[model samples]
Each structure stands twice: as structure tokens, then as C-alpha cells.
Target: MTHQLTRRQFGAITTGLGATLLLAACGTSATPTSAQKASAGDKFKKASLTFAFWGNPVRNAYTDQIIKNYEKAHPTITVAQQPGEWATYWTKLSTQVAGGTAPDIIQMDQAYIAEYGGRGALADLSTIESIDTKPLKSTLDEGRLNGKLYGIPTGNNAYAVCVNKTLFEKAGVEVPDDKTWTWDDYLDTAHKLTQGSGGAFRGTNWFGADQELKIWLYQRGEDLYTKDGKLGASVDNLTEFFAFVQKLFTSGDGPTNDGYATDIAAAVEQTLFGTNKVAMCWMWSNQITAYQKANGGDCALLRPPSKAGSADKNGVYYKASMYWSISSRSKAPAQAGGLVNEFLNSTSAAALQLAERGVPANPDVLAVVKPKLSATDQLAVDYMDAIKDEITNVPPVPPKGTSTVGTVAQRHEQDVIFGRATPVAAAKAFKSEVEGLIASA
Candidate 1:
């Protein structure tokens, strides 16, 4: 299928078109321009700054509230906010970055940060003295590489299964006791849930072949790549992961390639549990709010199924839900730093960040917003609480070209699932493709 930018997406890009134009106005000189220098100085009474990000209603509401609160606190500064839907947000931002007209404060994705940061597009956040990261010590630590902090995690997320309990009960498949469930148990239950015409809305849905395979690799304490750009796990491991999904597909416990390709609407579409074809599926915990609002049904978070006999079962880790970072190229680094600090630390800001994005990164933010959470949001909070001990903010950063590799890995698995390649062939092709990307980078 061809991917074309939607009209809504085009409108969003147009809304932020001026921000990109401003990049040309601010030339690519090695040193700051006079206006840039003046921005650093107090030459103007009012300063205009643009902050760009991608989000849905919840994130927009939260961020808009934070901007209002910040404006109230700093009467002289006006923040020009630009937001687009997630599908096209990165493309717009990348265009602006290439043109040297990116926003002063950009909501950064963990995958792209290293690439942009390494290329001098992102600001060396460590040089900014105003941001007191001491309060966010743990979260900040994940953003660092080679002794420099590049991005601050806005919040952390984890991989988990979201189960439609009502469906499980209706299907007569016992909900596996949360603490004792293993991978085989989950798969068996998923198979039992599979029944009726068009698969009867039981079992799980693998929207993308890579999703379940990644979880499988995680369970086995292996990953797509090593820290130093070498192949980490064997082709056999990846092939085994693919074979498991192939079995699930054969058993009607998951979607077939045609099913996902023809029907699935990406993450947003999958969150609507009452579409009722999927009984249990993988998701990030932070998505509960959107899921609740979009589908408005009974669903609960569960620990991802573990590999029954795998040695390292504690593979689940605290993953980041993007981040906020100052551009190394920004003229007003202090102000940008101050803005990020305000967003993460202020009570009202915390209230704005709640649910729309994920759990607040700042303990203070969570405390202030705790009483204001909805029932669904509170459930997410409870899950976070239960898994808090297992959650460690490890450096989730991959090398500069990891996204390219990830894209290849995903496509390779998709092809394998569609019967375009054998599992072993897919594994070898993915490795070769990704290794070439890493080499080029």
C-alpha cells in the first residue's frame, strides 16, 4: 500500500510552516546572528519561541495547559506551539531540522535523538546551566551517551498485554493468574480463545509481525542488535520467534498478514478493544488513557507473558515514552532549559502531562496529579506502582542509525509473515540490510 500524507496531516504541517520558514531567516552561519545574540540578551521585552511536538487530544490538552501556566508565570514570553498527529509529526520535524529551522524546544523520540544529537542538530543539553536535572536524576541519566546528556525522558513506559476481560470470561478461557502466567500458558489461552466465524474475536492480534517477535526476543534476553553495532543474537533465535508467530497464525490465535494489512489501523485503531477481534494484545502502559477514551470498554493491563523456561525472564524494562530536549542550536539555551524544567517540575505542568502523555517523570508531578486522575488513569498508575521495582531506567538509546535498522527488521518480519520469504531467509536479509545501514552511518 502507498502511504500518502492525509489532508488533516497536510493542514497540520501548514500550521507549522512558518516555523520552518524561520530557519532560512536564521542562516546556517557558524556563529549566532545579531537577532540570536539579542535573544540571549534582554534587548526585547517580549520573546517569541516555538515548541513543536506530536500528540492527540490528551497530550494537546495537557501541553496547552502547561503552556498557559508557563505564560502566566512568565508574562513577557509568548510560546508558539506547533503540534501534528504522530504519523506525520516526525516527517515535518525532520524537514525543519534539515533546513535548520527546527523548534527551540522539540519533543524528542528516543530512537531519533542519538542521530540528531550526533549531527549537531540537537543542543548539548549539559551546557545549559539553568535546568536543574538533579530532581530528575534517574530519568535524565537515560538521555546521556559518552558523558553528555542529550535528552530528558518526559516519562517512562513499559511493554504489557491489555486484555479484554469480558471477552476472556465469555470465551471460558481462565485469565491466567497474573504472577504465575508463562508464555506457553498465554499462548494456550490465546488458542482456546480462538473460535467462531472470522476467528470470533478471541485470542490476540499481532498488528505487525515484529511486535510479538520483539517480545519473544526480549523474553530470551536477546535483542535485534548489540551495543557495539555487532550482531548479538543468532538467526536461529529470530527464526524461532517467527515460527512461534507462524504457529499462532496457523491456529487463528493471531491475525494473518492479510488480516493486519487489510484491516488494522495502526496503534490508534488497535486501541479500540471493542472492535472485539483481539482479546489480548501488546501495548505500552501509557496508552490506557487513549484506549479508555477511544473504546470506552472494560480492559486491564497485565504483565507481558514470560518465556516459560528462559533463563533471563526479567527482560521487561522501563522504556521511555519519548523525551523533551533543547536544541544545541538554540540561541536561548537557558530559556529553553528553564522551559523544560518548568514542564517537568511545575504542579500545573504535571497536571497537564498527566494521562495525555504517560505517567509524569517527576515524582512531584505524580504526587500533585494523583488526586486528579480518572479511574482508568488510576488503574495505569496502580500497574506502574506494582511494577515499580522491576522498572529500572536503563539507557534505551541505540546507535545513530538504529531506526533505519529497526525499519528494516520490521519490514523483513512482515515479508516473512506474508510468505514472501522463509524465516531463515528473512533473518539473514534483515541482518545484512541493517548491517549495511549501520556501516553507512
Candidate 2:
């Protein structure tokens, strides 16, 4: 659910992509030369590389320490850190790539990986071997587009419902068995939590994000995009997706319109769930740490309610919370690969990150880090393990030209929720507009 750069903004970059060996798997590629393949992971060459990522101050400190430690390990290479906020990071990146001053190591996201890769801006990660990815297995597919690997997964995160045990306890309500919960159960619980507290705070937060919609679609054997990069969801599916979230507002079980905008944009510590204003919230697993820190209590993750009231039908899937990719423009591919290796596979680095980035994608690393993680982080890891069987396939790497999917989806869903548009009307407009966006891309 992280957006890289918008396609319109990338038009300038991709239009200049030449006969590329770095793009073999993403969008377009020509065969790499024997020399290029041979040099991919060559012995740590002496190179000063730049690494860029988006994060707040805490994550920045971790990256800074990781960089210092990496320099200590490989004295021959030096790294410069380029950190920015989410919006600013992508803006600066596009400018850098266009100017031929792109960083060597870049933290990537699923939403825009393909757009950047298709334009030949990322190295073919599959061509490199020194940076081992075997520990993560299939979760890496979230970074694969077209036919080749352009990005390496940093960790795995899943979208699910997080309930506050403290709120339930204060309301004198027993926590429902997530295993057998249905939509009715979810709605009922939200209502009871609200009523039990006499509206001191709302019951739940209503969100219509792509993650929330995908859970609903997956449970019904539907999906948003096909492997072929076309829309796989029907208008009817879109209608129901909007309709369901609309129930929260109509039933008076969710926050006010004024509060919805404010809460959704606030930090974890200031939001409803973070403030203990809601009994449950649908969110990415990576947020558990922040939510836990904010609430100062237990934040339990549960599988999203299913149609059949069974965990088997919950349709949860693991997504690489974020990723690492070597810039095609990098002069130090090996050194960049080494840095990514340190972040993803090094046990010491895993300890530094803990679950701040979600559960480590590598089981070997998780096995090492788990015992040392805080209780809330352990909760996240255990939740993922407990529901492994309920998970289906990893989501497809969003294809190039779909950068606006998340934004467009949220707008349409919000219209339905706020009663500004009917579900069916919003769905029709959403389908037409999204199709047009992809076509234009």
C-alpha cells in the first residue's frame, strides 16, 4: 500500500529507457551481456553509494546505525543516507533519477515498484546472488513484476482487525473468538462496544482502503487486479465493497465525518484506536508496534471476519511491508546489494529493526529476533504464525500505470461512506475512471 511515484510523473523517466538489461523481469528488457551478468555480484567493489528511504526520526536513527555498522564491516565502501518523508522522498527520487544522480540503494513499495522498474530505473535483482533472498521464499513475489525481480522484500505485513482488549474489558464484553467470527459478529461487537460505553468513544473506525477491500474480495474468490495487469474486480464487487463500509456510518457505529478525516491523517498516538476510542481497527500488521506504544496496552490482531464464519475463509495474504532495490543507475551494484543483505539477513540488523518494519521476511532472522522483541511485537509475529493456513497467495505486484489505484479507491469508498454518493453510482464511476487511468498509462 505504499505508492512509489505517479505514472504521469514517471512519463519523463520511462520514455528515456534504452535497451536495458536491468529490466528483464519488470516491464521490458533485452538480454544482459555476459560481462554485465558476471559483474552483478562481483566481490565487494570499492564504491561510495547513496541509500534513500522514507521514514520518521526513529526509523532514520535505525538506518543511520545500520549504515555505520555496515561501513565497519566493509571499510572499502562508504554510504550516504538520503532520508525524506513519504511524499518528499518520491518527489526527490524522480528528480534524482531524471538527473542521473539516483541513489544506489532505494527502499521501495509495491504500489509503484513496477512503474519505476518498467522505466528501467531499478537493477534486475534476480541477476544478483550475493544478496541471498532464499530465507523469505514466496513473500518476495510481492516485489516481482512482469517476469523478473527488481526489488527485495524487507519484511512481511498482513492487513487485519486489531482489537483493544482493554476497551473490551472496560465495556465488560468478552473478546470474540476470531476463528469463528462472521460479518455479523464484527458489526455486533462494534455496536455492543459503543453501547456499552454509552458513546463515550465510538465502537470502531471505518476504513475503505485497498487493503480492507482486498480482504473482502479475496474472501469471495475475487481480486482487484489480474496477473495480466487488468482489472479483475467487477462493478458489483466494487458496489458491495462500498456498501459494507457504508454500514458503519449509517448504523452510527463509526466516527464522525469531521473526525474521520482528522483521525485517518493523524499519527498512531493521536488516532481513535491509538487513543482507545475504538474497540477495533482494520490496519496493517506493521502498525502494531506504534499502536501498542500509543495505547500502552494489548493490541490483538485478528483475521478479518469471513462470510462463512471460519478463519479458512478470511483470505489474509502476506505483503512485503516494504522493499529494497538497487538503482539501475547505481555505479556500485555489489556494494548496494551488500547493504541490502545486511538489512534483510543480518541478525544484528534484525535486532535493530525488530518488528518496527513488520515481521522480518526471513524466518531465520525472525527466529533469532523473536526472543528479543517486545511483547507487542511478539503478538504480531504470533498472530501471523497462527493464521498461516488461512492465507492464500501473495498479492500481485501492482502493475505499472496503477499508481492512482489507492487514491481513487479511497475517494470512491469515502463518498459512499459519507453518503455523498450511492454505492452503485460510486462503483460505476470508479470503474470507468480507473480503467481510463490505466489506459492512459
Candidate 3:
């Protein structure tokens, strides 16, 4: 079986991250352009800054290479890289912030942007002179909160269904037309595949994810959060979503709770799709590379299901995969801002990093990197381009303490699946719990 970089594996690579802090001892604070020159006297000549991010080993390697190139270009600045897995990265960062030793630059996710920005932990990127905001004006605005730009969008990604063509062929189920397929078509296809596989396979492994709920809500002219930053989904929306998912589970068209637990607990390489036990699964477009590599099979990307013949098929949208932000407490804000500029706009860095961070947010960089991408990555880029005109406005930034909502949804979803709670009861409880979380925040 091919090895896939699962989230657990990514987070487990925590070695050597502490040594990055040692580089700070060797250099004096050098004057950086924009604000540092005006704030700090030119007494110190060298500046040492730490750029922290989380990713798989491949991302870490590319980031290290990019840092080397940046250092070679600016001899006065030395950048130490702090790499961690997603789960541990936040915990370590939170601890560092409490201790007054946060890294200068951070790789931020949209889910936590509001939480951190609201607490005044993120620096305003609008003041940075080196970062040109024109190319990705609309995308960059997704990172704004309270009339300030808190993060810079690194790249865009859309959710899609990744189909294992080999499995479809083996099961003799015709693939649905992604462009026109509705939720009813999706369920029918899934049922056909499950029955055709003689109980050896499932149709999909994505029923448990909250993203599906968001898409369903959007198709009904609602969203996960309202424009005013309140919980926007109604109980009817939640009940319908859970009921549909419950049918998929009980019908054996999707994974059972035990099967799901087993698959989800394993590495990505050992997932149902990777093992050819499922014909289709939902994933971010950016994950195609890893999923295909792990599965080692012919795969294709398709749009998610929408309501049939709905005049307003405004359900799908491109989301910022992640963002780059500067810490509010950094002593070398100018240097941090310059590094963010280099990461986003520098051709040399873009050439080296390519689409490892997802499609480049800079159109100039995208133009250069397009030809160099692998076939799978190019397909993801093309998918984003294809859907550019169809997607609706970006959803509201999640409110503070919004991260816990996923856990709550998962727990209640399992209750519905296990028949411990009716969909109506679970929906009411979920809404109350989430509203309380927001209230406490």
C-alpha cells in the first residue's frame, strides 16, 4: 500500500522544531522597512525572525527551501522555521502567546481567524507596504474582521467528490453527470454502487463531515453562519441533513459507525478510497494529489450534489485553504511583513513552492506555476477555474469559539446514526450548544 500523509502523521513530525529558537541569540535587531526603521533606532544591524507553520513533510521541505532563498537574498535577515502538525501547532502557539514568546509569523486557518483576531493576537496586514493586495482583492478581503485585514489568503480550494474510476468500473455503475447531478441522483448512484459491490464496498465516506451540511444549507438559501455572525442554519435544515445522512448509513450505502471509525482512525493511505473499498468520497480539491497517490488508482473530481433544477444553484464557493498572518506582539513587524510579501508575491519563492500550498493566490505566480504542476494538481486548478463564475459570495468569518462546533456536530450526528436521539432532538441540542458557545465567547 502507498503511504499517505494523514493528519496524525503530519502532527507527529515535531522533532527539531525547538532548535529554531536558538537562531535568535546570534543576531541583533536589523532595521526593516515600513515601521521598524521608524520605531527602532538603527543601532542593531541584524534581525532574526521565526516563521511558524504546520504541514506535512513535503510542505516543510519546500518551506525550508523558500526560507533559504529568502535569507540568501537579504543577508541582514535570518529566518528560523518552526514546523509542526496541525493539532499540536495551535496548542504550542497558544502556550507561546501566553508566555509572551509567540513566533513573528503564523500560518492561520479561516476557522480560527476570528478567535485570534478578536482577541487582538493578529497584526493588521493592511499596513504592510510590500504585500500588493490588488491581484487577490476579493480573496484577501475574506481575511478581514472589524474593518482590518488580519490575514493574507495563501490560496483557494473548493470541495469536490473524488471518485475512484477503477471502483466504478468494477462495480459497473455509470458515473453521474457532475454538472447536472442532484442530491437524488447522488443517493441513487450510491445505492447502486453499494449493491453492485456485493457488500465489499461503500458508496462514499463523507457523510460525517460538517462541510456537507454547509453545502446543503447553502443550497436552501441558508448558510452555516449568517451575515450578522449568528448561527444561520435552522432546525429544519439540520434535521433534513441528519435524516438524509441517517438513511445513507442505515441503508449501507455509506460506512457504518464502526467502519467509519476504523477508516477515519487509520492513516489516509488506509482510507476506504485509498484501499478501493469506496467508489467516491468528499475531499478538498487540494487533497487530490495525496488521495490519488495513496490510492494509486485512476480518479476524477466532480462537483458536489445540489438540488435538482433549482434556479439558484448558488451552493458552492471557493474557500481560502489557509492564510498567512503576522503576530501583533512581534518585535520585528517590518521583517515579518516583508516575509509575508515574499511568500505571496516573489517569483523565485513561487517557483520553488509551486502549488504545494494550494493554487497560488497571486495571478502572476499562478501563470508561472501552472505549467509546472503535476497532472492531478493541474486538474484541481482547472476545477477552480471552471467553477469561478458559479460560486456565490464567501461565507461570513466564523465567530469566536466556533472551532468547537465541529466536535458538537460530530457527536450529535453519531447520536442520530446510533438511534440514541431523533434528528429533531439532535438539531435542537446542537443549536442550543453552539449558541451557548458563541454566547460565552
Candidate 4:
């Protein structure tokens, strides 16, 4: 389906991002022409900075509150928010980056950070004293490319099984212990739940997403991309993973029925689990609050079932959900760094931020935010704490040439599921296609 940018989105890009992205391309620390020049050692100067990000209405609301707090604190700086949906955000940012018009402050993701950072589009964040590095010691490296810090993690997130408590109680199945559940056990329980629910709802909705692929790889003590940025899993591994995805869709006794394909593209609020049509599904723990707001906090988080039935050895890891990055070509690099500091350490931002961007990375931010959290938000935070010892370090960024890996993963997954190719053939072709991308890059 074709999607059109809303009036607000169009206005956001044309009115501000165009100019700012051009500034990013210029690679100059030229101050904004209209702002008052500041004294040498001042923390901030009077300036207008543009911050770009991807989000829906809910996240936009949170950001609006955060930005308001920042402006109130630093009365001279004004910020224009450039928000876009996930589907279009990267594409637009790429055009802006290539043409030298990237935003002053940008929301960076694991996939594209390397692409932009390696190409000198993102500022080296290590030189900025405004951004505190101590709090993010655990995850700081994930945002680095070749030892230069280009971004800072906004928060942490984990992929897990999300249970609909209301649906589970009605289906008469006991919740499985996340610590001990195995993939085999998960399938059996899903079958029982699906049978118990009759035709009104299914046990879960199977989704073929990159997040799932990563979790599956991690469970086997392997990774999707090696530290060197090459494809890590072999064709046999890909075949096994693809076959598992097909089983999830074809097995009506468990995770899916007829709606798996359609459901894959739906928003969080529209998913079967969110609409209370399923007992369980895999999702990022940070999304708990969004789904909870949609269906009430009648949901719970569990570690994804492990191959060996133990959470600790499952190779479960915490990923820095997203990041704050500055443009190498930004007009006001220092002020932009200060704004990034406020974004990461502000008490007001902490109070307003929940797991929407994942749990706060700073201990101080998490402490301040936890008391103010809604029940669902607390669950996300608590889940991370509950599994701290089991959590591994963040995965390596997918290298510069693999930003399109998500698209490649989704396409091959669909081909296998829809019978256009056998799992083995698809895996072979997928390995070839992905390796070729790395080689050409």
C-alpha cells in the first residue's frame, strides 16, 4: 500500500529539516546567522536547532513534553521536531544525509548508524563534553564505528514473549516459567492455548521480523553479523530458522492461522495480541506499555524460550534500542551536544520517558522515572532488572554496508513462507545475496 506524508510531516521537512540537513552536508561548525553570539565559555548560545526522529503519535507526545522541558530550561534555544513514521524516516534521512542536509540532532538506529558514521555524516561524539559517558558505560560501544563514538544510546530494550493475561486465564493455560521454557515447550503450550480458546482467538500471532531472527541467532550462541560485519550464521542455520518461521505460520495449533501475513505489517496497537485476540506473541519488552495502554496492563513479559531451556545460557542480550546522534555538518555542534545531554539526563525527560524508547540507560534517569511509571512501564523496567544477570552485552552494529539487512531478511522470509521458494533454496539464496552486499560495499 502507498503511504503519503501528512501535512505536518511535509511542513516539518520543508520548513526546517531541508536547511538543517544541508548544514549537515556542509561539515562546518558555522553558527546560525540569526542567533546571538555567546561568550566563549557559555554552556549554550541563543539558537534554533532541529531534531529529527521516527515515531507515532504516542512517542511524538512524549518527545513534545521533553522538548518543552528543554526549552524551558534553556530559554534561548528553540527546537523544531521533525517526526516521521519508521517506514519513511530512514529513506528521507538518507536523502538529506547524501545531499548534506541532515538534522542538527538525529535519532540513530543500529542499522544506519554505521552507514552514516562510517561515511562521515555523523559527528564524533567522544569529543563532546556535554554528553555524559559514565552512565552509558555498558552500551556506549554499540553506537561506535571503528572506535569513534558517533552516537549515544537513549535506552535499552530486549526481545521477549508477551503474554496476554486476560486471554491466558480464559484459555485455562498456566503461564510458563520464562527461566525454564524451551522452544519445544513453547509450541506445546501454544497448541494447548489455541485448542482451549476455540475459534474466538488464537494462541499467538507468528511474525517474521528481524528482531526474531536476532533472538534466534543469539540463542544458538551465534550472531546475525560477526564482529567484523560479515554474515555470521551459515546457510544451514538460515534454513533451520526459515523452517521454524514456516512452522509458526502453518501450524494452526499454535502461533498463527490465516492472518499472519496481514498481521506482520500492522501497528503495535492493531496486532492480535494488542486487540486481545491472542494469548501470547514475541515482542520487544519496551513495547509493553504501548500494548498495555491499548488493552490495559493485562500483559506480562517472559524471556524468549531457549534452545537449552535455561535463560542464563540462552545468550540473551540487551540492545540499545535507539540512539541520539549529532550531524558532523551541523550548524551548532556544541549546542546540539548540549541538547543531547538534556535529552539523556534531564529529570523532566526521565519522568516523561518510559520504555517507549526502551528503559532509560542512566541509573539516575531510571530511578527518577520508575516511581513515575505506569504499571505497564514498570513491568518493562522490572523485566530488565529481573534478568540482569542473564543479559549479555549489546550486539555489534551491522556494519556500514548492511543497512538494508532488514529488508533482505523480510523479503526472503516472505518468499519461504509463501512457497515461492523452499527454505533450503531461500537460505542459500539469502546467504549469497547478503554476502554479495557485503562484498560490493
lDDT of 3 by residue, 287-319 (tens): 888889998878888888888534237377777
lDDT of 2 by residue, 1-441 (tens): 344345554554444332232344454333233213525456377778899999978899998998898898878888888988886677677767655677888888777687678667787887766588788676767878788788877887787888888888888778889999998898899888888887676778865657776778777788777788877778898888778777877777788776777776677889888888887888877678788789876679988898889888887888887889887766667667777888988999988887777688787788888999878777788888888877775667766677767767877877877778999999899889877766765
lDDT of 4 by residue, 1-441 (tens): 112333353344343434544664676443333122222234477778889998879889989988888889889889998998876786688667655677889998776676677666777777666677788787788798788888898888777889988877888999999899987888888877888888767777766556677778877767888888888878887898888877766777543434666666687788787787778877777778778777664889998888889988666677777899987767676678788888787776777765567788788888888887778878888988888888773577877556566667767877877789889988898889888867765
Best by TM-score: 2
Candidate 4 clash total? 5
Clashing pairs in 1: 122-328, 123-327, 123-328
Global local distance difference test of model 1: 0.65
What candidate 2 gets wrong by more than 4 Å, as runs, is 1-41
As a whole number from 0 to 100, the lDDT of residue 153 in candidate 4 is 84
**Model 3 quality (TM-score):** 0.87
By lDDT, the best candidate is 2
lDDT of 4: 0.75
- Stretches > 4 Å off in candidate 4: 1-42, 45-48, 56-65, 75-80, 85-88, 255-258, 293-297
**Backbone clashes in model 3:** 1
Off by over 4 Å in 1: 1-47, 195-199, 208-214, 229-231, 267-272, 292-296, 308-312, 392-395, 404-407
Model 2 TM-score relative to the real fold: 0.90
- Models, CA RMSD each: 5.4, 3.5, 6.2, 5.2
Could you give me the TM-score of model 1 versus the true structure?
0.82
